[model samples]
Target: MAGVSRTVACLRFGGDDLDPDEISSVLGREPTYARRKGDVWLTPKGLRRVAKSGIWILNTDDAEPGDLDQQVAALFSGLSEDFSIWRNFARLYGGDIYTGVFLSQSNEGLSISPLTLNSIGVRGLEFGLDIYSNTDDDQKGVSEVADETLD
Candidate 1:
């Protein structure tokens, strides 16, 4: 008889908001390794599977609390080498998720705040913008304005 393997790969981003089974369904395969508690596992073929099927999900809306563009810019500004993988993960999921506000930005720079994903018991993320300027033919003007303070 041969040993059975339930090959699966699971990854938890900061918390258990996402489930491995759910991920398996998305990838249509039995995971060989499970990710949780800030650890990654790989069986003989699990690594290859994960490489082919990138991980990350986005849930954006207008009702999300906080300054959307500012938060995104801040996140980009604060990114370090340590966060390269996660940043890539975010990009793979949809850089649009973070840049939704930029996409919606008008010539006047007026747009609604973009929604962000939040896990239970996790601190709510917020953003503040110091400036939003628009330049046209050597002329610069503030297109949109908001309070610098987050809250």
Candidate 2:
């Protein structure tokens, strides 16, 4: 399907965007929680569905930057390039998904959120963001892509 194929930060997603905590209240949960070993957030039960979080049921309308805002910023900062993409994505998609990464200003880790697409077609991507959230928790040079696991 044609959809957003890019990921970026919402530096330009607007300062007036929705707050993360408010989004959390709407969704009824914290931004991130520890994932128990050998546990999955989503599970299949017959034709029905079950999840530990609403992440799997995320809709483009709910993923908007206004709902998520830069809440991840308190947890994730120092974006080098994706900031531009975030602004563009917000203007185009107006929705997003929290990947559930948590961080304190002194934690030495980066947080990430995904922006879903508005127009899905034969030439578009399923979703896209302008930036890549780096999950290198340690100050070491190790790096892993956040979108990989979020999707």
Candidate 3:
């Protein structure tokens, strides 16, 4: 098996009445992207639309694309570790950790560590995973050389 090629992790909080600034204040960190309900926003494809609800997103860009657990840990590194604070935030804004996994081959697979799961569970954050497969078969073999876990 080729295994996973890369992973990206991000923390998000969203709700109809959510205020990015308010959440930022409590988290003591700035958001990578944030918008209020009904605010004008533009898509990466250049499409323009209005936001349906307020959202605050914090991305782990500083972390290299590799282990999902390590990436998730990087996202939470400096953030509050208090369960009550996270639970309160989730109750009000519905927070979750979203992870995007890019597979190098059709049979690629990965697993999450129990320690990482425990960390997420204690924070009251919902965990989500999205897998993406490479459409081009030509690069499938490249993953063998590029897989960081092998190092």
Highest TM-score against the true fold, candidate: 3
Report residue 102 deviation for candidate 2 (angstroms): 21
Model 3 agreement with the true structure over 47-98: per-residue lDDT tens digits: 7878877888887652223587887788788777677988888888778877
Better of 1 and 2 by TM-score: 1
Query: Which of candidates 2 and 3 is the stronger one according to lDDT?
Result: 3
Clashing pairs in 1: 7-30, 7-31, 7-32, 8-31, 8-32, 8-33, 9-31, 10-35
Checking candidate 3 for backbone clashes, the offending pairs are none
Evaluate residue 41 in candidate 3 and report its C-alpha lDDT on the 0 to 100 scale: 70
- Tens-digit lDDT string for candidate 1 (1-151): 2211111111222223435455445434443333333334353334522222323322222212224444333333322323444444333432222222221122323343333233111222222223222222222111111100100
lDDT of each: 0.28, 0.29, 0.71
At residue 38, candidate 3 shows an lDDT of 92
Candidate 3 wrong stretches, greater than 4 Å: 62-65, 136-151
Give the TM-score of each candidate: 0.21, 0.20, 0.83
Error of 1 at 57 (Å): 2.5
Give lDDT for model 2. 0.29
**Compared with the true structure, what per-residue lDDT tens digits does model 2 show for residues 1-151?**
2222222222111123334444344334343322222334432223422222222122222222222334334222332233444444344434343233222232233323433222121112233333322443432110112222332
Segments of candidate 2 deviating more than 4 angstroms: 1-17, 33-93, 97-126, 129-151
